[model samples]
Target: MNPNDHRAALADIQVTAQDVKFSTIVCFLAWTFAVYDFVLFANLLPVIAQDLGWTAAQTTGINTWVTIGTALVAFFVGPLVVDRMGRKSGIVIAVTGAALASGLTFVAGWMVGALGVLGLVLLILIRSLAGLGYAEQSINATYLNEMFSHVDRKNGGGASRGFIYSLVQSGWPVGSVIAAASIAILQPLGGWELCFIVGVFPAFIMMALGKKLKESPQFRARQLVTQWRSQGHTAEAEQLAREYHIGEETGVSPLKAAFSGESLRPTLTLSAAMLMNWLGILAFAFQGTLVLTSGKQVNFNDALTILIISNATGFLGYLFHGWLGDRIGRRNTIALGWFLAAFAFAGMLWAPNGSYGLVVALYSVGLFFLIGPYSALLFFNAESFPVETRATAGSFINALGQVGAILGGVLFTIHLSGLTQESAAELISSTWINAALIWGTVPILLSAALMLLARDVRPGRQS
Candidate 1:
């Protein structure tokens, strides 16, 4: 074997256990806080409007603008920023900015009583600003994948990644629960402003963590490449490896040239799969729990209760998918998840009225598949790209996922508006059930087909 390979083999032997634990905790908590902030907007929108005197159209408009603003910014600028700044710094920017924007949005809404159109404009401004920060979720996932080793990635791929991911991912449900409960509790006393006010706190805490987290080791390795070039070195394979603290130079391009050619096949495939997966999630987020439980006669608490259960169940599913992904492979786990989710969603369509139990079962199972396999999203993207442009690749793919989120919102509003008063309840159920079935099946089929194209960069192995 060449000296370059010898060095790489040696470096692998020295990786420590402590590095794994420390990096995981730092990465996971940062993600949890960010997701919590994002989920709060969806959960609390109704309460925000009820207290603020906005029309339903206005409220929907606000969300639409925010989603569009974030998507546009993420798709265009996100890759550049992430690739330039690297993961840790990019996450800090996303979390800190998002937190400030969220807080400012509350302030803007408060001013609406006095500022009139100006106040409403300010609310839009702040919400849109928050959207920019929320867009960071895509970048941070790349950071998480870069920090761990390959075996750790494959073995603990689901467990280590899943458990922490589930906890953070659970933030969606937790945020929903918090929003639902807080709005109900505070509406009589402080009004909707209280919900926005409380939502700001998590962002503050996230800002604190963002301050101290380390850059991923993979990032450090990349930094060495620049160092070698600047130092008047020849960029010899072995020399580059030694400079980067890598055992062997591996003769790999840090900017990931491999993903540009035929490798683009897998890239496009996974992107499509992830796009559908996220679109389904967006669909679920936009309507699932709320539509299933809504009616003039329905109790708000009952609706909230169902959401809590759905989110809680989703948390467990994230863990299960993670473990399964490590043992069985990401594609198989995701495909099976989609199949189960489709059946459950279909059940909701056919189940009898007053059958809240059955509705809950159907929705919960759908949520499980919706949230679970996707937990490996960051890992999957990390492996797909070469280390050089890992952040860019992940960021772009994630931005596409955000695009799906925007579509979900639009689809939900269109469907909900089309429902007439005479057949509203049945229409609601049938629409949601149908929507869920559609989202559950098509995306997974696309995802499974794409899986056949994967390079299986299951960590430790050389591509």
Candidate 2:
């Protein structure tokens, strides 16, 4: 390409400072809302289970089903939908779908008297609809990666990118804090159903913000290339292709592209790593909720307090790990997080019954390490793939993680069901060490090992 045409292409794709700021804010808000919706359900699961006549086993079953549905949508549906509609439109639709589905949770409560068992079915269906929006989380990752490509390419930009990504990733704990506060404040006044009603607000806010988002330049460039090719403007198409370093066939099926040749190794390795990581996460999230509310370890009030404090500390981990990822390396930082988290989980398991401070500290540290590298992993995963298949590949890896979560839930339920209530209570109170060994320690160590096999894909770093 000539200098004039090269400049023109650059002009068309360059992102301004304002665009970066706006994209970051909107992406952060989108993540915040997504986690708010997700964690709210976990927070209120006990109340919902009681209202719907669900036993502990049944509750886990519902979670498994929901996760399975989420995986299916994220893996099979997300790539096709996002690739067709564009990321911005896909996110808007997802946010709206989540909000609408969440609102129906309120209606589920009303229908219980008239529909009885059918209310349970309706509620599960509604929950699955909300789960479908999990795709937006992956879409956001891809969008952020692409939107900041120019910044990420500069010298010393990796750390800056990691910091920004961490800030956005902190939305998970922020949303968790919101969920905790909502339950502590609102659940007492109007019950869990009302909390679901309040949860709908953030989704709409995200939808409004998402509407103003511009398409990523990489995506737009791909579109322009396609248009030029279709118009038989071979010269312009080839010029743009060379400028962008995009391949001739830019529109290959994402799934085919993701699993083909060199991409397959990292893709499979990351998927395995995600699976193990999520197993540990699901175990802690669901089992912690049970241990807290069941009074096996602590009272509901005390549990909520512990959760809020732990999550607040975990928020700091998100930022710290992001910076660490840039400084050390993505794989090393993530491995360090896993190693620390394994020890923290052990500490939580062995704390004495009356050692509230010890337990809280252990839980907080464990939560921090467990979640610390998540943002970095997302950054790593996105960078691992080319623009054409980034979203699909990342979403597929996340879908595999959801499957691991489902398996975790099932295992927890099966174990719980095998013992009498008294024995189960005793086991939880005493044998938590064993539980931690299987659920938290083992899985995380495995995840860390898997990270060793996967290449680091940080920007400005060679794989």
Candidate 3:
């Protein structure tokens, strides 16, 4: 405990590259399946609707309800479970549940053409279950946070996590590619049933691989969750005590205790950050595909291709942004991202017809900024909240963000159709106009303002 001993201990402190790499890979894989399952539902909606006897309205309704379900359930219940059950159990159970739900989707698809209300009901239920699993984003964020150390937590917070999340986020594009390719390959052989049946394979792999996955070390350290310590593995518990400053006496409900009057600044800041984060998610999910859909004579393949490109580009930007956030500051990086996204959205509104090159460029730039903040905010939120409410705050913030997502879908539907424009060119213009209004100017400005008012919570900085 003397200065010499402390200095010596600091000199010997080391975290191997191998450890970081292995941890990152595991997290990436976990997130990849999580993203795949979440996005797969939307990616194959066209096939699902056709094979399941859904009208346009009905299909849209299904998506709306799923968002609503995610917003409602994930916001409150998801955090409670994650906080109470611990990140390891939350992820494992969520993955297993999603796998089972996907299996059911395959079964429902088998009854296609002659599908009944029963089949439709089952599919909807399964989709809702998958939405529940989507709540794993919070758990995954906690897992990644726990895997790294104090130094790693500060420098590698978003940098490492962004890369992992980028890979996981890539699941959307990959799932779309897989869905499109599978439908093309299997449509002739076994019809849409083949696509759904094939879909179950990935979930199966994810579930099995997840079996080997260990609980996050930090999760074991938290004072609120006791199961990790109850297993009698004191090495991890003791290590956590030394590293994270957590001990058995301190782990209580984070939400209940972390948000006292004294902690209002962090509470409000995280709430705003999470709110905007979910809004971005909504915009990406609905607007990304919609932009291409509004493209003249654009096919599903082309739409999916554009999405893949956007996601790929965004992934790279995430890494760049993570570095920026760690080096510069989370608030500055996030604000810069929002501003860039806003600018890109504005350009998209004014671009000429069939200007696919310019369109993609602007959209890509916007997405770059969007993901920089999105990727980094996980750590920002985690660091801002106390250990007791860490998971709870994430759950609440993310759950509330789902409301923004629901609005994004509804806004797109309303404005795009209600524009009173006949030509596809005009429709595209109007859609961008509406998107600019919703996602571009206003949201960015609001987020930037919020960031300005918020307190920074990066670790190592005393409040």
Candidate 4:
């Protein structure tokens, strides 16, 4: 074997158990906090709207703007920033910014009486600013993959990676549950503003945890090789390159590398899948609003109860899909998830009005299917590119997904306008249900079909 191959083999023996533990905890919490801040506004929008005298259209418009902000950051800014700054620094800044923005919501709420329309505008601006922090999620995914390289490739691939990623992605439901619980507790105490206030705490926790994080070794090694080469220490660079089995230095920009030739196909395919997934999530975002405003008009406590239950069930789905992805492979698992989610959403739409049990059951199952396979999907996206361009590619796909979120928000707002208090209950229920079918079920099925074209990147497997 060549010296490089031997060195690569030896380097693999250097990973320690502590490294895995720290990487997993730090990445998972950072992701969880990022998602928590991202979704916190959605959960509390109704109360905020009422306080600000904003209409449904205005509310959805604000959310759409947030989606747009997320896309812009994830696609245009994140790739460049993360690639240049390193993942650890990028995530810390993003998370800190998002947390501070979330805290600003309370200030916006307080200004409503004085600023009126300006307060609403400020709220929208802050929330959209918070959305920029979502770039951390895509960046961190790449970090985790590199950090867990050894374990991720063990047992035919995806054993450790799948479990860790699923756990990390479960941060979505966990964040949602925290949102629900916070609203449940805080809303009654000091009203909606308190919910935003409570949401800010997770950021501090994440920042503290983030301080303990080490830069990804892969990133460090790559930088070292680049530095050596630039300093004309070609021999040293070559020595390090063999130890890491690093590929030839590509002259192309990361963006060009991500979409060039063969890579373009799977890149587009995963982007399509993510777009549909976000569309469904945007529709699902209305569940709280629908339950509160439609068919029998349940109280805030009841609506939150339903949401908590549904999100709790979503946690199980994440675990299931993580396990299933290892067995069936990422593409198959994601396809199955989308298909099952479509049926579950359909059942939710078809359920009788005022049937809380049935609605909750269907909602829970639908959410499970919609959310469970995300970790595996993300893993697949990360694996689609080389280490050099992975973050950019994943973030680019995420940016496309945000476009779907914007569309879903717009569609949801338009549909919600038809469900005024003067409207008949059946009409109100059916209008939102039909919107859910269109926004949730249709795209999900399309995503499933698109999954057929995606290449599975599981270790030891070829598509």
Candidate 5:
């Protein structure tokens, strides 16, 4: 590549400042509300079960089935929609799908009496749409990763990149707070069904905002490379390849590229780590109030308050780690956070007395590490693969977190038999400590360990 071709390739990839901020704002809003629906379901799970007259065993069964559907649906968004269509398209579809899921969730409540278990079937399918919401992170991460490439580290744009992304990923804690608080407020006004409606409007607005987003430069560059190569314009193709660091596996399909040669190791290790980490996230974060209530640390009413407070504090973790990841590296930041999170949770679970303040303190510290690392991990996953396979591989890893959720659900159910006799308020399990430790702390520790196996996610970092 001569200087002119190199300059041309760089010119093609350069984006305006407004485009950057616009993309970030849209991604943040899209992620925030999508996760709002996901967390809402968790917040309302026990209520949904009680309203539908499902016992503890039956409730976890429903959740597991929904997660199975979510895992299946996840493949469609990342591999098919994002990789095949475009990153911008994937964002719009994912946000819209999540909103549609929320509206249908309200309908599922009514159908239980009319359709009986079939209504639950409807609920399963509707909730499965969260697969789109879950996949949105990878798609947005890919888009933002490419968008931020032009910004130089020496000028502080690189650290700002991490901070910028950390702000977007902070949506998890924001969503959690919204979900828990909405239920607390709306449940008294009507029922848990009202909370389902809250996610709908904001999601649609984000979807509309997402539609206007520009296709990522990397996506456009990859397409140009393939077209030029096939048209026998080898000079242009190879030139862009040199400038943009185009991936070697360009000839193969996106999904296949994800599992082949250079892409395979990080795909395997990162996917495995996410699987283990999410096992803790699903069992503890999703059903956080129950973990507190079931373990006898706090009663049901107080548990909600604890969840809201503790999750709010978790916000600080995202900023701190995001800033930290840019200084050292994303992989190191992620592993270190999760490793410490495991101990924080263990201390919370086994404290001599389950005092409210102490429980809140320990749980807040635990979540700070547990969920915070994702601020780096999501971006790490994006940078780990080339633009061609970025969405597919990242989404594949994200989808497997559902598999972890399935594993988490299994652990939750296996221990629920003894705790099932009472309603959620009076819920107590002599096995709670054992179950929490096994499913929560144990898997989180393993998740941190798996991160050590993967390579760093710097520029063109995929192995």
Candidate 6:
């Protein structure tokens, strides 16, 4: 087999079990708090809107705009930061940026008076900086994929990687819960400004912990080749490339390489799938409180309670999907989960009103399928690409997902604004309900179909 760019697949890095444990802990906490920052913005925006004189429509607009900036920032982080810098640097900067975003929210309202509407612009700009943190999911996948590749190489694939990475990916639900629970608890005590300020601490702490992270061995190896080539050590570079059995694309742009040749199909497919899945996320999860509160008898607090409970179920789903991916395959696991999620969500929508117990049950089930597969999704996405383009591919697809978020947000704003006050009040009766159905269900199913187009690279021991 030319060792054929496969020898460096796992890069015989000297990662100890302790290194894995330590990196996982750091990634988990960083992602957890990054999510805390991300989810908190949505949950507390109503209060922030109230304080800032924005209508619900305006709040949605702000979210959409921020997502645009977030997509830009996320793209920059993946290719410019993660690809250009080391993974360790990328992760550290991500958490630190999230901390900065959360801390700056307190001043966003004050800017309206000084910068006029541009004050709000400043707020969007500030929040979008957390896009780096949002991109942390990609960093975790690439970092851990490299780390996990070294283990059980004798086994056909890195059997335990998906399951272990699932533990880190659970940061999403944990952070989401923390965001909601903190708002429930803290909003009354001071204000959302307090919550925003409070949100900064955890991310900052995680950034400190991220400092302890060792660079991924694969990344170091790649850098060594690049360095050797740059220093005119062409023979050394070629020899190392030959030794590792990898193609030497030393100076090629990772993003460009990601789109060329065989990388092109998976890149396009994965990007589209994430875009569709994220549309679903925006419709159901991002605007979760709205979906539950609309046309239902539940108050905001009750809706919040349901969100807290339902999202907790995501933690279990991650573990289960992670475990399942190890046996069957990460790609298959993601597809099955998302496909089932469509029906479960349909059941959620179809159930009769006044059945709060039934609503909660269906909603939770839907989320279990919807959000759970992500535990496998990130790792699968990472492994699908060659090492050279791993971070770029992950980030590129992830950034594309924000396009779905933007589209979903715009659709939500249009639908919500079209609703008369009375019509908007009814959950099942409004065109808004159809909006939910389209964004929430159809996109999920499509994303699942797209995943089937994926041809994943199986794990093998480093040559």
Quote the lDDT for 429 in model 6. Answer: 43
Model 2, position 318, has a per-residue lDDT of 93
User: Which ranges in model 4 have alpha carbons more than 4 Å from their true place?
Assistant: 1-15, 150-158, 242-245, 286-288, 295-297, 416-422, 459-463
Superior candidate under lDDT, 5 versus 6: 5
Question: Residues 352-448, candidate 1, lDDT per residue (tens digit)?
Answer: 7577788778778888876766665556666566566667666667667766666666655555555543545655556655554565445545555
TM-score of candidate 3 to 2 decimals: 0.77
Q: For residues 1-463, what per-residue lDDT tens digits would candidate 4 score against the true structure?
A: 3568547744744555587688677777777777777777777776776776666556677778767776776686456777767777877777777778778977877886788778666766777766556676677777777767644444244455676678887887887888788788888899887777765776777778777777766676778788668877688678867755455688888788778865788888998888887888777754455434553355656777888898899899888887788777888999999899999888877777678888788888988898888877777776677677777788888788788898888888887765554567667667767777887789989999899888766642311
Best of the candidates, lDDT = 5
Q: Return the TM-score for each candidate structure.
A: 0.80, 0.92, 0.77, 0.90, 0.92, 0.91
lDDT (Cα, tens digit) per residue for candidate 6, span 349-453: 777767899889888888888889999888888777777888999999989988999988887787666554344356334554577787778999999999999
The digit string of per-residue lDDT tens for model 2 on 242-307 reads 655567774568888889866798799999998998878876654566555553378777887888
lDDT of 6 at 235: 73
Cα lDDT listed for each candidate: 0.60, 0.75, 0.59, 0.74, 0.81, 0.79
Instruction: List model 3 lDDT by residue over 241-268, tens digit each.
Output: 6666554544445565556643467667
* Top candidate by TM-score: 5
Model 6: CA > 4 A from native: 1-13, 50-56, 110-116, 151-157, 232-236, 242-245, 295-297, 420-424, 427-429, 459-463
Candidate 1: stretches off by over 4 Å: 1-16, 49-61, 76-78, 111-121, 132-136, 150-181, 235-238, 241-259, 295-298, 418-463
The ten-residue window of minimal lDDT in model 2 covers 150-159
Per-residue alpha-carbon lDDT of model 5 for 1-463, expressed as tens digits?
A: 3658656755766667688889888888888888888888877777787777787767777888889898888877887888878888888888888888898888877787789878878889999998888888887788888878744421345655776788998988988898888888998898888888887897658756866787777777777787678877788788877767786544677778889877899999999999999889986798786677667557666888888887887888999888888888889999999999999999888885457777888889999999988889999998788777888898899999989998888877887765554545434544666778998899999999999999886632322
